[model samples]
Target: MKLEKELIFPKGFTVRKVIELVTANERFASKIYFQTKSHQCNGKSMLGLMSFMLMTTIGESYIISVEGEDAEKVIQFWNKFVREIHENTTLSYWEEEGAQTVQEAMCQSISFWNSSVRSVAQSYLKPGKKEI
Candidate 1:
């Protein structure tokens, strides 16, 4: 199967992202997908995709080749799957710091803020004995 058309993606979806997604997600790892293969598309099996080890560098592209009566349908499904992931936002690993360290954390944060303010003020100061 050879991809008759090109599938372009943005910089964020580079080879690193492919590897990260595949490794982190069991579903993706199990899917029959290939980054590179003799056919445009590889077998829709996770193991098959793992074997391809696609060079997902910037501007790298792959052809998805399929045949038979279901070729179009399979292509659509593949495209849709990729599209969904592309549009989704990655969840943040760190949310709020939480109240576990509120006391010491608050003090440290305040100190940091004070230091930042002092540093910024120093840049704008005239020859003076520091403005409080």
Candidate 2:
């Protein structure tokens, strides 16, 4: 089976969120790839994802292709993951102190990657409903 979807990063989206996607890909047997206008890379590779991210900006759409026995499952996971990221970005931007703008929230999220406060930002990445 094979599935593909075009998805856009919501406001306040950061590289750390890409890490979440890469991590999730590890659970499936699917061979997943992410494509931007100028580049394409394996979804399971952090370096590839980072390189791909460089060619795009927030709100820009990209295509994700998944193929294998678990393609449907991988697609479902992405749908839920993207929805959660959007919802959490909205909530975190408004709810977190000192984050008066979406960009601030994004910067804060990047900073979270290094400190103990990472857990706080990571909470935003948690799936809202049941896991796929």
Candidate 3:
């Protein structure tokens, strides 16, 4: 099984959040990849993620692809995680930090999904196999 979703980095999102995401990915058996328009890397690899992050900016969108027995669950987890970040950032800036108005927060927040969830047939190779 394979599941994919495009996600935008929310406001106040940082490298620490990416590390948290990668850590969550490591907890599962599923293989995950994060892809920007110009690059893609294994979501489970710290080095790969760090390199990928360097090329991406806040508010940039990326696709996350998950494959293996837990693909659906992985996708679900990511959806919830992203939503939490989005909501928390919005609320924190508006209410807690008082750095921005609610309107400003809403406008500045990166849109989480530019596209809907896509289910596709397996196309990525397993470990030790070249991707076709």
Q: TM-scores of the models, in the given order?
A: 0.40, 0.62, 0.60
- Per-residue lDDT for 23-127 in model 1, tens only? 543333222334433433245444445444344432346655555545566567667756775566353322122222333344454445677765664554445
Between the candidate structures 1 and 3, which one is better when assessed by lDDT? 3
Write down the worst ten-residue block by lDDT for model 3. 116-125
lDDT of each residue in 1-132, candidate 2, tens digit only:
889889885554478887887898988999999887778999899998778866666677889899999998998888888787777775353533422254345445574365655555555443552221
What does the lDDT come to for candidate 2?
Answer: 0.73
Q: All candidates' lDDT scores?
A: 0.46, 0.73, 0.71
Clashing pairs in 3: none
* Model 3 lDDT per residue over 48-108, tens place: 9888877766578999999999999999998888788877664343434332243344334
Clashes of 2: 0
Better of 1 and 2 by lDDT: 2
RMSD of each: 14.0, 12.8, 17.6
* Candidate that would win on lDDT: 2
- The TM-score leader among the candidates is 2
Error of 1 at 80 (Å): 1.0
lDDT of 1 at 107: 42
